[model samples]
Target: MPKSKVRKKTVYTPPSSDRTTTPVKLAGPTHPVYIAVMLGMMLIGLAWLVVNYLAGNSIPFMATLGPWNFLIGFSLIVIGLLMTMRWR
Candidate 1:
């Protein structure tokens, strides 16, 4: 029987580049007000939609705004959702 040959493996090295030595500042915890505002926006948006659906024809402002009510509700919800990304 013939003896099998062993294969040699090369060590892997990462490519080096010009990286800054300065340490990055870590972000602090999100402020309580920020969390409140974020939650408030989402809740307000949902409430707005609910109000529009429930009393759009009866409420003067909602009736006047008409389709714009949807925009306001969705915009608030979107703003709140965007804020979540920055939440700690």
Candidate 2:
């Protein structure tokens, strides 16, 4: 019986030596209205904190949330930051 020959496997690769990069087309909110909305949110968060500090019970909803004031405020700021990142 004839001896069987082993076959070598080759992996496929890109022809270009340089690494390929896909163009990232990020859709950013360039609309002035949208930017204003984000700014409003950030300002609202700040105002809420300040009001809670200066005038107690000024913001009824803040009391309802209890210690989450920081959470809410920071979340609003973070959202604004995210919007800024996407803003063109």
Candidate 3:
């Protein structure tokens, strides 16, 4: 009769002693024009809400013409200004 040998498995783990931390810094110009445009659009939206409330005209067309148009126009104007400035 032959005797059988049993083998044991070993688990490996990485050392956690070596660690590095780096601080992240964001880079970009804080454009005042963009802020102004956003504020203007918000004001326009507020005005539209006020006008709708006062007039009692619950027309869907006003939604498209009032705040929506202001947002689109404001966005376009801001983008155009940014492009002209060439801020990269």
Count: clashes, candidate 1: 0
Model 1 C-alpha lDDT versus the unseen true structure = 0.97
Q: After superposition, how far is residue 8 of candidate 1 from its true place, in Å?
A: 11
Query: Model 2 Cα displacement at 66 (Å)?
Result: 1.7
The candidate with the higher TM-score, 2 or 3, is 2
Best by TM-score: 1
Best-performing candidate as measured by lDDT: 1
Can you rank all candidates by lDDT, best first?
1, 2, 3
User: How does candidate 2 fare on TM-score?
Assistant: 0.58
RMSD of each: 3.6, 7.6, 9.6
Q: Residues 31-82, candidate 1, lDDT per residue (tens digit)?
A: 9999999999999999999999999999998999999999999999999999
Q: Can you write out model 3's per-residue Cα lDDT over 2-88, one digit (the tens) per residue?
A: 989988887888788677878888668748886666556555656655565565246767655765655555565555555545443
Worst lDDT window (10 residues) for model 3? 79-88
- Give per-candidate clash totals: 0, 0, 0
- Stretches off by above 4 angstroms in model 3 are 1-17, 27-29, 56-88
Ranking by TM-score: 1, 2, 3
Question: How many clashing pairs in candidate 2?
Answer: 0
- Score every model by TM-score: 0.77, 0.58, 0.36
> Candidate 2 lDDT, tens digit per residue, 44-87?
88876777677635667767877787788778877887788766
Cα-based lDDT at residue 10, candidate 2? 94
